[model samples]
Structure formats: structure tokens, C-alpha cells
Target: MGACVGCGGSQSPGVFVLEAGTYARCDGCGLASLDPLPAEGAAGALFEEGYFHGGVAGGYSDYDADGALHEANARARWALVERHSGAPPASVLDVGCAVGTFLVEAQRRGAQVAGVDVSPWARAQAEQRHGIGVAASVEEVAARESGEFDVVTFFQSLEHVPRPDRLLAGACACLRPGGLVVIETWDAGSTVARVMGKAWQQMNPPTVLHLMGRPSLAALLGRAGFELVTVERTSKLVSVGLVLHILADKFPALLGWLGVLARRPWLARLTLRYRLGDLVTAVARKPLAVVGT
Candidate 1:
């Protein structure tokens, strides 16, 4: 990976060369990313409907771990809600919300919640299980309603989008004034990333379109008309999901059981508190007034 000639930064073989290098760290805001995105078709193919929506079945784990992960994620959403409104936002949109865990929690907290995901399977499950409104694509959802959301979140999902700038812009357009855009993603500058080097799970060149640090993220958010309201390095190591993803990929036979183990009370507590393998959490807000509002 090397910088893109256009950006004078490291570049990767990915088709969208925002910069050079396997990843590019934005000097303006500290966002690091996989530049030269994988050929459009190749990357899009990886997210084939089935891979994301269907056949997830037993692959997700049996029971306890599933609940634990969902509950933990809910807690994260609740925290964001508190930061944004000292309470839940009246309306919310979760981009790439898998199975609607966060949206469910937000609903329970009194927010009128909706979610958008590309995976039909995931959408079905979220609707059936959580009773949340679901859309097949962000554009479709955004087009249906303008300035409809009080809070928009991309939890571990922003990195998957090909053109983050466009995505963020759309999100900005979808949100009402003073709405919040909360993003939770792998921190490319984390100690785990440095330690793991190329072996880092997020370094999976063609898939993770962008690997952002706080600076880069802030810059991107600013470019999209958001203001950095809060930024924190999650106490977690940021390696946990990557560890699980790797195990699932490299050792499929062990995936199911390991997913179960991930929920072990002892293991769960250790992971959550000790940062056994979590990463970064960031929150930004669209100002109640845009430049020309």
C-alpha cells in the first residue's frame, strides 16, 4: 500500500484512491483510510445480499452471547442519546443497523426509530424481531423523508461505505437541525492496530474502505457539515470484533462455539470493561444552523 498520487498519501490497490498507502491518515483531521478502493464491483460483490442478510443462522452464535452483544450495544446507544439530548432523541435513524439492536433500545427509550441496511436478511430479522421500520438502502430511506431524524448513527458501519463523504452528506441532509450523527468504528491509530500491523483485522485491504482515526473522522464530519461534539478512545482494545471476524474467517468450524464463548459472563465482563477488544466511539452533531440556514 502506498499513498495516492492525488493526495500525496499512501495508496492501496482499492479502486478509490483517496490517497496513497495501504491506509491514508488525514493530516487535516486524523482520519486514516484504505485508499485506492477495491474495484467497485469487487467490493460491492463482497456485500452480496446473502453474505450480509441471509444464511446468518447459527453462524451468529446460540443464545447468551447474542443477547450480551446486543445489550452492550444498546448501552452504547443509550450513552450517545444521553450525550446528545440528555435523553433520547424524538426520532432516530440507524444506518446499517444489524438486527435492530440499537434501534430497539432507542425505541424503548421513546424515540421513533427507523433503520436502513443493505442486507435483506438483516432487515427481515430486525423488523420481525424488533418491530422497527426498515429500508433496503439509505438513499431510499432518505428520499422518503427529508430532515426526518433527530439522531443518525453509523455504528461500525461507516467504514463499509464506498464514498463516505457522500454518505455523510446524505446523512446531514436527512437530519433535522441539532441532530446528532454518532459513529463507532475501528480506530486505525489504536495500539492494537499498531501492534498487529498489516495483520490487523481492519487492514483487510479491499473490504474496509476507510480506516479512520479521530482526526480524519473529525475532518470528514466537518466537511459534511457536522461539528465534533465529543470524541473518546473507547477503553476497549478495538481488537475484539476483528478477533472474532478473523476466527470466523480462518476457522469456520470453531466460529459458532467461539461466538458462544464470547458471551461467557466472565469473558464478557472482562472484554467490556478491560477493552478486551473494543475500539473508538465518536459523536458529532449537525449544528441547528448550517452555514446558510
Candidate 2:
């Protein structure tokens, strides 16, 4: 990695390796990224049905099956945005929205919600599930209207993008003056990340390019023309079913115990709240006034 996507800082590659991918760190900002990052917008083709249903290309394993957990997490994230905005947002956008799970929840709450997902299946699902018309990207949404949304969110999506800074600037362009942007991604600099070292599950690359942290993410927000508001730990409520699947994947040796847990079908619907520091959220606001345009 010669340059950082988060802050455009110079980066040194070969700092480390995690799961068959070489890692690099920004010399100026300490942002870790995949060396020779994957092509931008490459994640589009990886979001089809198989991606969500079969865990293709590091995608989810039966994403829609976790609707309860998805809705719960969505509600939590939206509540955070509301707390910062002090009210329900007039309009909201979620970038890289796989199937509008979050937007459906927002729609139920009476907010005009929109989304951007490159997958045709996801786009159709968004409209069918919640009547939310999805754009291919922020540029497509900006083509129709700039400064149109009150809030924009990147819930667990930014780290996977090849050019986070560019996408962030586009997100800023989609926001009205002083609008808020909520970004929630994994933290590579957290204590758990350090302790786990290379064993950290999120360290997967090509699928995950940037290993974002509070300082690096703050810098990314600042460079994208946003004022840093707050950074905090965001909890994810994952169903026990998903947990068992992860356990099976990571520790095959525990299959005996995992099979026991999987035998209880009710556990599939049971959700566990994880308030891990490694999962971080940052909310930023566009400036009310610009010095130059």
C-alpha cells in the first residue's frame, strides 16, 4: 500500500499478514489496509443472492434469515442517529445497503428512506421489501439531488470499499448543510484486535481493505468535509444461529459442542448483544458554511 484510502497518506506495505493477505499501515495516520487493494466497485458483483445466502466472497450466510437481528441492529443504529440529530431524520440514505433491512425499519418509523446497493437483486429486494428505491451508488443519488438527505449511514460497509475517501466525499455531497453521517465499522486498533493479533476474524482482506480505527476514521471524516461529532462502541445483536455458524467456521474442533447448541432450534431466534469495543461507530456532520465552493 503506497497510499491510504482513508486520508491519502503514504503507507508502507508488508507491515504484517492476516489470512493470506499482506497488510500495510499508513505512515502518517496509522490506517491499516490491504496491500495492492482490490479494484474499486469490485464488491458489486459479489452481492448477488449467493453472496448473502451462501457466504460467497466473504458475504453473509443467509443474511435475510437474520431479519430479527438485522432489524434490532438497525433500530439501534437509527436511534443513535436520532440522538445526534435530536429528532427523526427527514430523509435518510444507507450506502451499500444489502437488502434495505435498515431502511425498512426506518420506513416503519415514517422517514423517507433511500439506499445505494450495486446488486440488482438487492435493489429489487429493497423496493419489494420496503418500497425503497435503491441507487447504484452515491453518485447516482447525487445525479438526481444533491444536499437532499438529512442523514446518511454506512453501517458495516465502508471498510470493504477500496476508496473510502472518495465514497465519503460523495456521501458528503449527498447531505444537506450540517447533515449527519453515521459510519459503523470494525476497529483494527482495539484491544481485542491487538490481543487476537493475526487470528482476528475481521483481518480478512480483498474482502476487507481498510482496518479502520477511531483516529484514522476521524481523519477520513475530516478529509471528507465533515466535522467529527462522536465515536463510540456500537453493539450488534447477532442470533445464536449465526454465532454457532461462526463457531463452526472458526473452531471446527468445537463442532461437538456447537452441534449441541444447534440442536436447540429456538436458539436460532435467540439474539445475543455484543458491545465489543472492536465494533466502533462514528458520527460526523457537514459544516453549515463552507469557506470556498
Candidate 3:
């Protein structure tokens, strides 16, 4: 293992191994990242059509299957954004805005919203289904609308980025002064991760490149000219059927049983919202004035 990506700390072997890759933890930042990180295009490959439908190991069982549930979750996230930064930002940009669920909710709250996703299928769905402007990358959006956004979000997408520093820099460049950046990512220092150890379902390779804790994340935000506002754990609502389906992927023998339950209309519709204290939501603001400039 080399120096830590988030913080230049001495690296030691981690407790988990996935797909022949070893995860190493940094003594300085507590980020557990895959050694010999995935290739340039590996992250993009995970967002294909089969990812949402469970053809892949680290993806959702049926992402689009729970439309109402997803929209409800999106609305809840929007409420959080409003709680921290106030309602109806002048403009919002969603990085890795898969299918634009959050973008739609932001629009509903009266923000001019746009999104960018690496997956063509997702981008198309965001544009055609939600009628929101979707681009392939922040660079593309910046070409047209630089420093014009009031809020930029990375909802469950920052962990997948190979270079988070670059991602934050690009986001900062695209934001107006005092703009807010919202991030939701898995925390490596959480109790659930410590308890599960290597068996944690999220410790997979190629899909999850980095696991960031609050302190490391705050430092990253500050380096990119953002002031950390809040860091807290957030809950997500997932269906019982979806949970079973995800479990089935790891325990193949349970697939038959889980499939049966997943088909039951009532069981499939049951939703639970709980905080595992493993996921962190950090809200940061770009400094009102550039330091030393």
C-alpha cells in the first residue's frame, strides 16, 4: 500500500479482501481504500443497466422498481438540505445524479436544477424522464455555466470516485461564492463497519474505492475552500424485499427464498428507515472570499 489518498498517512494492511484486491487503512485519516486502485474507467463501468437490476455484485437489486419509495427518499434528503442551508437555492447541480431523483425533488422545491452522471443510461433517464438537463461530467457543465450554482451535491457518489480531491476541486470551481456542497458517503470509522470487519457488504472493490470518516472529510472540504457546516449520520429507507435481494447476492443459497419473498406484493412494499450510524452526511460551504487572493 502507498500513502493514503485522502491524507498522506502511513498505510497498513486492512482486514478485508475483495475480488483479489486488498483494502488498506491509513493511520492518519482512517480511510480504508483499495490498494492498487481500479483502472481509470472502472468506476464508470459499475453504473451500467445491470447495476440497478442486480446483475452486478455491488449494485442495487432493482433501483427503478421502487419509484415512490425513491422519490420519498429524495424528498427527505431535500428536507435535510433545506434544514441546513435553507430552502430553494438559486441553482443546484447534482454530481453523479443517477436517474435524477434528487434533482426532481430539488426542482419541486423551486431550485433550478441540473445533473451529471457517468452512465449514459442514467443521464438519458434523468433528461428524458425528469426533463432535467444532464451532462456527462462537471467539466462539461462548467463549460456552459461556471460558478453559477448555489448548491452542488454528491449523494452516495463521492465514495466511488477514484480521485476525490479532483472531484472537490471541480465542484468548487463550478460553485458561486458561499455555495453549499452536500455529500453523503460511508464512514469507515462507524461502529457497524468496525463490528462487521471484513464481512461488511460495502467493503467491495471497484465499486467502493474509498471510505471517509468525518475528520478526513472535513479536512478535504477545507482544502478545497469549503467551510464544514455539519457532519451527521443520515438514514435511508429501503424496502424489506430490497434488503433481502441485496443479501441474496452474497448468500446465493438464499436467492430462491428471497426471490419468493421479493415477489410478494406486500412484503416488497414494506419500507424501513433506520440510521446504522455508518453513513455520514457532510454539508460544507465555499468560503465567501478566496483566502490570500
Candidate 4:
């Protein structure tokens, strides 16, 4: 394993990237990816039991607090929605659309939104609760749903996939010409990563196989046959706080609730570090001429 998207140096490499301070930078494309990504089968288990739907959703309780999180999510949704002016396309697809938050927002804006997620629990909850269409798999959705979409979004869901290239290909396939693929992911090259080092929450191992940066991601999209039209770095204030909380919680026995008090007060210096970062949003357009790559 060397400098390839899915390739990395094998230090005792099994099937997944298992070390710290080491990454496989793709030669084909400069997208730095973690090698020995989770096994194909292991992905489902890791996602189902290890993170997301596991038990961490509660950590996002701030979202439901007095509708503050919902308000923030709605703001993000509207920002993406406003980006696409004129007419809301005929339909849209949201891959890895957990709980269909964006789907609901898109629907409210008069777009026919459908989503696909691996978790049956999330799908059922979306349909039962939100009344949206959800498929169990991308392949199943592709087969059942035809025609192209105006927009395809993968918010905070790209890094979770073991194979980002394959996932991008699939996402591109679902879009119509001139369609947009709006992606929001953690920028590993951001100041947060630079300052926090390995403690950054997005760097959580065994799950996030790729720590994408702006340049590498743009390269990956170009190679995937998409033109990077617009790139915006949005402040992920809550997410940064969440990462800090995760770090604090990891040392709960040591920090306890007083972790809020920052004993080594120099850390207070990094307080503003949270707001300065971005979620690295890129709106890549599927070429109007090319149907497939």
C-alpha cells in the first residue's frame, strides 16, 4: 500500500487502516485515504454498532434542545437550497441520508426528495415519522428510481464510507446533466486538525477511512468526471464543540464535568478555534455532456 486513495503503507496492515500518524495518499488522485479500509462486510457492522445509530445520536441532543439544533440544521438546509435558484428540480437523491433531515427540508421547499441509507432503523424512522421515501440500498434505489435528479447531497456522510470513490461514482450516476452534487465533509487539513492533532473527532479511527482536504477532494472530483464549480467553507460551530466534547468525554474519569473548566487554561486560547473552521462544502457539477465516466 502506498499513495493511492484506498492504498496505504501496510504496517501490520490487515484490511483496515490501524495506526496513528500514517495515511495513504492516493497517487492516481491526491485524495489522502486510510488504507486497509474496513472490510466490505465489516462496514455494516461498524456503522450499525460502533457509531451513528449506535448510541452517539444522543450526543447531538443539543439539536433537539429548544429546537436550536433543528434551527441550525434548517439553516444549513436552506443555505444549500438557496444555492440552487430558479426551479427546484423534478427529484433529488440523498445518499447516507440519516433520519432524512435534509429530505424533509428539501420536501418543504417543493422538491421530490427520496433517500437511501444502510440503517433500516433510520429508514423506518424517516418514513414512519417524516413520511419520506427511503430504500435499503443504493442499488435498490437506483433500480427502483429512474430519471436524473437536480441535486444529490451527502452531508457529513462521505467520510463514513469505506470506499469514497465508489460512492462518488454511484452518486454521479444518480444525477442529471448540470445536476449538482453537494458534499459536506470534515476538512482534515483545516486548522482544527492542525491544532487538535489526533484528538480531532473526525479523525476517529476504524470508521472514518478518509480524512479529505479541499485540494484532494477537488482532485478526486475532477478525476471522477465532475467539475468543481463552487467551494465554500462553512462554520461548523456545533460540530467543533462536539469534537471537543468527544475528546473531553474520552477522558471523563480525568476531566469529569469540570472538563468544561479547561484546567490547562491555555486551551482557552483555542476556544475561538472552533468557529474559524469550515465544513468544506463543494458544489460540483456533473458535466452536461458526459452521462457516465
Candidate 5:
């Protein structure tokens, strides 16, 4: 009933339906998106303090509770960036940088890092706790420092935005020549997504606006003036408590077990690092010749 976020083409109903809304796939680009879209202020409301503590739907349960696991996840992602790009960037901006965990890791690696998040709580925490420059949104960051960053990252946050193209454009506008744009997001075209269909945990509506595939993602980056570099599946190191917290949402029976595990500090701290293959990390670069173009 609405135009697709990926291609602006007519959309057909998708296989999933949640309490929030129905989803549809684009005939042209095949990106699945929520229909009717989220009300203007609705999406931002999802990132409040309640989001990290499981008070809100489609959000984590106690995101800050596992500090060591979060840092390990950030280190894994930073390793991926170094493997693909081969150097520590001079400056970096992280979009949707909740609590600045990744930016903290980037700073440890000698990158000057700034972050933007919709949640004031997150922004304040990033600035106060991590000492990173934090703002309310990418537009706000662009206003103060356009074309000033050697890297722009959207780690597991792009699909949550209502306008991904606008987000990418703002990131591109903030990058220096030959700078990189790194994205970690759900890949709807991946084997796991195809096999799991509507039951995929990433299909939560309203919170997740678009499910991007590799081809659509490439087209979007190209349109935003980035040349594709690498796109591949990436793994994360997550605590057992966090994984159980997420799974408990879809499978309520797991809650009893999760509750038991939560009381056990040793078991809760266990970390798993494995590739699920449904999520992808991509790197793209702005050409050196097109600094302002």
C-alpha cells in the first residue's frame, strides 16, 4: 500500500504481521518494510531508558548489564574494520551510538570518535561516561562538523531508521575524501533470513523499518556517492544473559530458564562468538577525487 523505502516502488504484502504493523516487500528492490510507517515521534520513543531494560518492545533487556561482553563485541567489530580497511582512521562518527561502546573501542585504537543517538539518555551517557562527542542526531552532527570524519559507522542501527537514504546521505556528507562508511545490519537476502522467513528475530516492526539486502544496500551506497568495498557476514560476542533475554521475547517458555540464568553470575557472563549469517557488515568508500562532489 506504500512505496518501498529501498526503491520507491509499489509494495506487496509480506509474510509477517506483528502487533505494531504489517510488513511488505518492494517489487523492485525486495526490501521488506513496515506499512503505514511509524508515527513521526514514535520511533524516538523506543530508545528511552526503558529500551535497554526490556520495558519497551523490540528493545534489549539490560543492555548495559554486560559491560565486558559489550566491549568484546565492539572489539570484534573494530577488528573487522581493520581487516577490511587496514588502518586506524583519524576521525570517526558513529550513528545510533547507544552508550558509545563501539566508539570507546575506536578511541582505544587511536581514532577520534564522536557519536549521535536519538535518546538523550544515550547521548549523555556517551559524553559523560565515554568522553565522546555526542549529539541527538546525524543532522545535528553534520551541522557542526560536515565532511570532517575519516569513517562513519552505523552498527546494527540502520534498519531502525525511517529514512535510510537520508541517514546515508548525512553520513556521506560528513565523510572526508576516501573515507569509509561501515554498516552492520540485517540482510534479508541471506540464507538464514530466507529459511527463517517471518520468524526471524530481526523482523520486529516499528522498531525496524527496513530489512536491507546486499543488492539494495549497494544501490543505496552508490546513490549516496560511495563505492562498494566489502560486504560479508560478521560475528559478535554476546553474553549468555543478553542472548537469552532476546530469545525470551519470541519464546516465552525460555523466560523461566533465563530468569534462572540471570541469578547465576558465572553462567550469565559466558560469551558466544559465532556467525549467524543473516547479519552482514559492509564497507564502502567515498572516492578521493570527489571530496565535495
Candidate 6:
């Protein structure tokens, strides 16, 4: 965690200390990460069934319960990629695609979609419920299929990994030349994040490895041989229960009440369309030419 995930630059502390952790900023690119990040083994465990079903700090709360909302969000977000891509993608690969909600939407729009997620439950849900192809890693997906995807997406999944740069490399390994890489994650430099200071929701460490902004994300894209395309604040539509699920971490007392509220069909059904501006969606393009090829 002391080194920048974007540029391999040394990091220094004293940036922001919230809760029981510290956020260290990279000296070279301003990328911030959880100092003393959780062990890789420990971090890997965060993406299990519970993570998708309300067992972890940053995981979803009744993810399947709000399937309609996720679908709507996916509907809106796929537009973001399409508008920047110049054409509708024929094939798509999604990294860290938990339960494949987004891919399910992409498939509806007439694209062949595949996913890479660490959670077995997530993969099962994606395949069994939606018939979307799901794998455990980019390498596994690349082994069977090489350089065929037209677009690769990482919606709210990049920050969960220990090495964002390495993850980008793995993503590009499956992309055809000139294919697009789309990302959506927390932006540390957003106005609300700056105003919230240590209280920013995305500051949850170990769960979110990097607090990346536009520049750092762009830097990571450059390092991965991607030409930056677009980076902008994005919108989301989420349910009320999902909000409670996110807050359950700092206030575990709410979990029991949350379970009760979730049982109430009316309360669980409430959703809001928000543009809080703390999150960004980025798109980059892989080059048509490579040294080896």
C-alpha cells in the first residue's frame, strides 16, 4: 500500500485518517490507498456469498432483492459506454462483475457478454439466473478466449482489487485491438468527497484498496497501454435498503433493524436516482498496434 498502484511511486501518510485506518497518497500521482492494507488472503475473502448478500462492510444488502433497480442502473450505465465507444459493442467482458447484473443488461441489448468475479455465489447467480458466462479471473477467461472482446467494463469493481494496474493489464489481455476499457469507481477528488473529509463513504479501507481520482485513473490507463477516452461523473439509481446495507458497517446495530425493514416490501422498494458526483465512469481505448504483434 505504500506504493502507488497506478505508477509505482512511493507513498506518504498523514493524508486522511478516518475510523481506525489511514489513507496514504502517492507522491507521484495523488492516488490514495488504505495504508497497511489487509493481507491478500484476507482481502480475497471479502468477496464471498456474504459480500453480495449483506455480510461485509462494503458489500450489497439484499442485492437480488433490488434486481430491478440494478437493471435500471445497468441500463443507464451501458449508455455511458456506448456513447463513448462510437458503436455498440458486439462482445463485452466485465471484470469483477458480481452476479453479472450489468452483463445481463448488455445481453438484452444484443451483445455477447462474459464476466470475471471472485465470488462463487456471484458466478453461480450470474450463470444460473441469467445464463451469463462467468469466470474467476481474467487469466482464466483469457486462456479459453484471447483478444476477442470489444469492450471490457469494471463497474464499481476496480477499487475492490489490490492491484488496479495489474487488473487493467489482465483486462486488456482479452480485448481486441482498439477495444474499449470502461471503469466506474469512487473519485477521491470529487467535491463531496473533499467536503466529507474523513467521513466520505468510499474511504472504507481494505474493502476499497484505492481512492482513485481522474488523474490517477488516467495514469493507470496510460500504464496499461490504453488511450484515455472519457472520464466523468456518473449517476446511479439505488434502493433505500441498499443505503441501509452500506451503513450497516459503521452502525452494525442497524443490521437487525435492517433485516426487519428489508422484510417490509414497501420500504425495501424505495429507490432514488442520484448524481452525488463522488463516483466517476471512465473509458479508454486499447491501441490497434502492439510491439509483439
TM per candidate: 0.74, 0.92, 0.92, 0.78, 0.92, 0.90
Q: Please report how far candidate 5 places residue 226 from its true position, in Å.
A: 1.5
Task: Give all candidates' CA lDDT scores.
Answer: 0.66, 0.83, 0.82, 0.63, 0.82, 0.83
Rate residue 215 of model 1 by lDDT: 64
Prediction RMSDs, each to the true structure: 5.8, 2.2, 2.0, 5.5, 2.3, 2.7
Candidate 2 C-alpha lDDT tens digits along 1-293: 46687777888878877555888989877889888887876777767788777465356656877877888888888789889999999899999888898888788788888899878899988888777789988899988879999999999889878889989999999999989999999888899988887666677666777888887998999999999999988789887777776666557699899878876878766778876679988999999975786
User: How much is the lDDT of residue 196 in candidate 1?
Assistant: 68
> Could you give candidate 3's per-residue lDDT for residues 1-293 as a string of tens digits?
77776766787885467654678877877777788777655676678888778677778777877778889888888888888777668688999899999998888888898898888888878878978768888888888888999999998888887778778888998899888999988887899988987666677676778878887797678777788899998988887867786677666788898888888978877888857899789999988875784
Model 1, 1-293: lDDT tens digits are 44422233343243323222366554544555665455422434454444442223212323233466567757766775677666658888988787788887887778888888766667777878877768866677789888889888888788876667777888998898888888888877678877766655566545576777766677678878888888776542212433454556545699798778655545533343435333677788888874764
Model 1 poorest 10 in a row by lDDT: 53-62
- Model 6: how far is 43 from its true place, Å? 3.7
Clashes of each: 34, 0, 0, 7, 0, 0
Comparison by TM-score, 4 against 5, better one:
5
For residue 6, give model 4's deviation from the true position in Å: 7.4
Q: List clashing residue pairs in candidate 2.
A: none
Encode model 4's per-residue lDDT on 8-108: one tens digit a residue: 22223232233442455554434555565566435555445234422452133123221344445656655664565346655778887766777777777
User: What's the true lDDT of residue 120 in model 1?
Assistant: 63
Best candidate, TM-score-wise? 3
User: Which regions of candidate 6 deviate over 4 angstroms?
Assistant: 38-42, 248-264, 290-293
Give the alpha carbon lDDT tens digit for every residue of 1-293 in model 6. 56788888898886878766788999888899888776543554678788777777777777878888888888887898788888889999989888888888888889998899877778888888888878888888888878999999999888877778878988888999999999998898899989977767787866887899988998999998899988888889888877876666656677788777877879867998767998789989999976785
Scored against the true structure, residue 272 in model 2 reaches a CA lDDT of: 84
lDDT assessment of candidate 3: 0.82
